[model samples]
Target chain A: MGDEFCSCDILHENLIEIVKKKMPQEEKLYDLAELFKVFGDTTRVKIISALFEAELCVCDIAVLLGMSQSAISHQLRVLRQARLVKHRKEGKVVFYSLDDEHIKTIFNQGLEHILEPRGFEHAVF
Target chain B: MGDEFCSCDILHENLIEIVKKKMPQEEKLYDLAELFKVFGDTTRVKIISALFEAELCVCDIAVLLGMSQSAISHQLRVLRQARLVKHRKEGKVVFYSLDDEHIKTIFNQGLEHILEPRGFEHAVF
Candidate 1:
């Protein structure tokens, strides 16, 4: 698959046409990359799931995840910065919830894909 | 935000209610983390964007991104294994496209979040 991927075969006409018509700008590509990077963390994803169904404060998140309050706080900072979660203050407690539906959409979709009866991601074995 | 997040304050009543109702299982959290991790790479994100709009062979992907066919092919393997993209062969050329629509939804949502008029990810961010 390696060298073959670079093989000097004549280019496919359809591929060439599509590339010319649909190529994205470099900055948009970079932005897309950064966005995915935000999702790539284990702790963050768990935090996201915890927040998916309810708004939670740091202490609440910590307890739900079986993590320390300090740990939940750190990840929440990352999530808040990524715009994956938003918050409001009630007295001194900051309640965090998913910023939008995309988190759940992506999560559920991925889950569905993996859980498909056929296999996990086209046969992990 | 630091120490306060860990303060021994009694948990808020609403928070306890939500956490109890919403906490996810551990294995699901791990799987969710793995899913997000798949999205968290710059090169992979670009590859995803390109495929979002077109079915591409390795050479084509390399050309569109000004990358080596070898490099694009490497990333394609990762994408395929993750089930973020799928491929088919026509003669000797293998073409790749997104595995499904989740990639697009997630990407578009992140773009919308960051590009919001007020600011990015909570002011500066």
Candidate 2:
């Protein structure tokens, strides 16, 4: 299986060179991966999804997802650290929302990939 | 910490009701998180980034990323399973490219998020 999938020879060194030059710095890519890892959790995704419709407090997110407020708060901290979601204080209450439109766009783009029909036959690597 | 961050009361039942009605089914959200989880890996993100530049064979990808052919192949399989990437056979070599434009858009959106400056004060909650 490995032999069939991976050739020892560099098939296209020219293309590789070009791509290498254009690729983002390793540090940036690492940060990008970390950012996606934040979204990779079910609880955080639910919080972001709920916030997509309306700004939400921790208690509200917990209620919406049928989870405890403490659990919701933990995920909110992750989201905030990644800067995917931000919060505002209204007196004693705090409302959390997507930091910007890019969160919604990123989520929708993934949804599009999931929703789109596959054009090619599934290959076993 | 928990008390300050998470209120016991449902602050916005009306807003929760609206978001609840509009939220995608839980199963769909689960699938969405799974898709993001695929993007969370550094190797997979690097592979996707390279493919963004041009379609290339596994060996080419392995060369560009300075990783072993077997490691690249493993990541390729995960990418293929998630439908984030597609492969085509050209004679004896197999070339992989992103599954669609959505993949690029998703990656770019994440990039935008990382690049954008935080507008709000970082909250501790």
List fnat per candidate, in order. 0.60, 0.73
lDDT of 2 at B10: 45
Q: Using DockQ, give the best candidate's number.
A: 2
DockQ of each: 0.51, 0.58
Model 1 docking category: medium
Q: Per-residue alpha-carbon lDDT of model 2 for B8-115, expressed as tens digits?
A: 344566777889999998888898999999999999999999988898888888777778878988999888999888899978778899977887888988988888
Q: Assess chain B of each prediction and give its TM-score.
A: 0.78, 0.83
Candidate 2 structure quality by residue, lDDT tens digits, A24-108: 9998899889989998988888888888898887778877787776788888988888888878998877889888788888999
TM-score of chain B of 1: 0.78
Compared with the true structure, all predictions reach lDDT values of 0.71, 0.83
